[model samples]
Target: MESLKNNFATKTAILVDGGFYRRRAQAVFGDQTAEERAAELANYCMRHLNFHGESSNLYRIFYYDCAPSSKRVYHPFLKKQVDLGKSDLFEWTTLFFNELKKKRKFALRLGKLAEEQAHYTLRPQIVKKLCNGSIQFSDLQEDDFCLQIDQKGVDMKIGLDIASMAYKHQVDQIVLISGDSDFVSAAKLAQREGIDFVLDPLGAPIKPDLFEHIDGLRTCNKAYTAHTQK
Candidate 1:
């Protein structure tokens, strides 16, 4: 047992915030199916080591997200009522969930989407136009309306895993692919435990305070277009 413990090599773990990564990927790589997105994720994690000419001793990849909510709402573009649970968005989210389950080194951590009381609000640009008298209230269209859903428990699960990795010495490095600062405190704790903490903003601008908490910032693949086209 002692020899086995001593022989354990330093390993790297990747934690991704699925929603953040997906939005950025859609902008950078255009629309992609869940399988393509998963491949991109693994490519990003491996790129970290390849950049510095190191071999991969990947511990695992952790993905955190909330399942799509089952709620009915007005569809602006379609100009009709629809069930969010039955929308294409929901179906795609489920496909993404299932694809992750098939990967050997991937861990899918699910949370919940909380639907709040519905409220009517115009788009910010539309509101500005209305205020400027460029558009009248009577000119408002059904397409201008939008619905919002809040995700819960994702960050908590992420923080708990970070703490677990640090306390249990499960990994020597952590690569977090998230832009939110909610993980700053957890990142600090990991650093205090002598683990290297790296942040992959995936081309997003990060706040200065968040910059201070991480050992470095890196994006595994910058040529997002190349990956998507193939």
Candidate 2:
């Protein structure tokens, strides 16, 4: 019994939805370089350990994201083909992934961007304006459209990993860093297997239904932490 008590500290595995994290980080923490972002991610995951308890140990951090599409797509407004591989975003993402690879106990799970379906779509605001007749189609500019691409295999990878970890007892707890509710099934499975499932939405509001699936709600971001402390 003493041996079991001694090992009672939680073993936690962190799973990050890379796209959701990047968007939230930019909104809450502002922009940072690839190296800085990678460091921030590592620090953020470590914060979860402290939250659990001083005795808690980190198992690993799994980051799921799709590689940026490098395909050239023709822009109707620009009337030209743009090579996405030459864009700053592509370069930044590449650097970011490389930086993540260097972090200890970090695993990069890469999915694929649906290149064939990639195309430019109007921004939401622009679409709204057009629909409301506040702006005419002739007033549109190239900047109004952004590339749209479907991410493949990222969610599946996250779910499979969660289920695998739960069944294998790789960790006593799982902390998922994502705002999407698509993980509900996996979270439920983990809980059924006696794994503690926690969600860190980085301060984003989650659906009320999501509350039932998680063992706890916690956000480790600097802004959220500061707000809570006050």
Candidate 3:
């Protein structure tokens, strides 16, 4: 029993915040097709297994995200209603999810977008430019506004899975890919249960307090490293 315990490989589980990953990936790795992005995701996760060399075995990769809202909404700038279902984001997201489903050992957890509360909001930088008088109201473009929708059940699902994995001893390590600090509580629970909780922010800056909750900080892929250096 002692030898078996000592010789066993370290099992690892990777949890990705899909929305955060997509935004960061687009910024760091440039744009790619859905199939290419899915392959990139798988390759990125494989890099984590190398942290333990030949002693690490992947248990699974959990991706949390919300399905795009297909509702029609009024575009204040365009003076018309826009069908989000026909938008590029909706199509791309659907294709991305389908690609992810085909990857081995990938578990896709989907949450719903709060369509009822969805509204168009100007992008932050655009708002800043307007405030500084660098851009006039007449110069505003339709593309400057984005649909803001809250994601329901994603964080709850992620937390529940982390707790379950920790309690069930399903994995020795839990690596979260997110820049959000909301996962601190879940990280704490995993650490208390003896799981090594790691965070990979994909070159995004995190809050200083987040350091207290994680076991280590690592960005496994070379793309993230190159982006950070720049």
Candidate 4:
């Protein structure tokens, strides 16, 4: 069954929120790029959704987020080091965003996981810190806490794409990456239209009620997603 599902999957898409990434940063990824982030997410979706399905036609990842991807360009994060009240990270971000615009690989961190990952992604330094008492559980606790804030504009995109795909008959199944309760309505509509709607946890703990309308969801492929940036 697993092999068949993996083989048959097709026409997948990933929808994201620009403001969500920015807020997740909450001052860490000081400067963010939508295109770069979108591209990365698209890659993630493509891999998981089996863009190259049984027919070898991998699903098209439709990135939906606010345009211009530039909401953190001049955000204030400097505490008087080299410049007084000037956002050095944001300044550096201009170059990062430019690079992302060109290559679309400089997407900033999403939030806490993003922050620590920026400095340390399965790195030896982190391992050394753990060995030398430089990093501890407190660091883990503080970084793991998220002060949930409203991410507007994402709902509309999710709604539009799910409906569009169903109306256009784009795929045999639709998988969503979010657990936010807001998408219940959209998921229901897709199921009503006879689309095989599936929700993927991506290894994140799911909130039970998400995708109430969808059915037959497979737990994330642990071996594959164990390395996802949380």
CA lDDT, every prediction?
0.79, 0.90, 0.89, 0.48
TM-scores for all predictions: 0.84, 0.92, 0.92, 0.50
lDDT of candidate 1 at residue 139, scale 0 to 100: 90
lDDT of 3 by residue, 1-230 (tens): 97786577889999999999999999978999988999999999888887633357899999999988899998899988899999998899899999999999999999988999988999999999999999999999988998888999999999999999999999999989998888989999999999998899987888877778898887876655643320
RMSD vs true structure, all candidates: 5.6, 2.7, 3.1, 10.4
RMSD of 3: 3.1
Residue-level lDDT of model 2, residues 1-230, one tens digit each, is 97786667889999999999999999988999999999999998888887834357899999999988789998878989999999999999999999999999999999999999888889999999999999999999888999989999999999999999999999999999998989999999999999989898899888877777888888876557632211
- As for TM-score, the candidate ahead, 1 or 4, is 1
Clashing residue pairs, candidate 2?
A: none
For 1-230, candidate 4 gives per-residue lDDT tens digits of 98776665355444433344334333433444645543444455555554323332444443333322222222122212222124343454344344444533222222211221122123455457777898784455323332222334556767877898888887766766554567778778888877777665444445557634666454334443442321
As a TM-score, model 4 comes out at: 0.50
Sequence-dependent TM-score of model 2:
0.92
Cα deviation of 154, candidate 1, in Å: 0.4
- Ranking the candidates on TM-score from highest down gives 2, 3, 1, 4
Clashing pairs in 3: none
The C-alpha local distance difference test score for the whole of candidate 4 amounts to 0.48
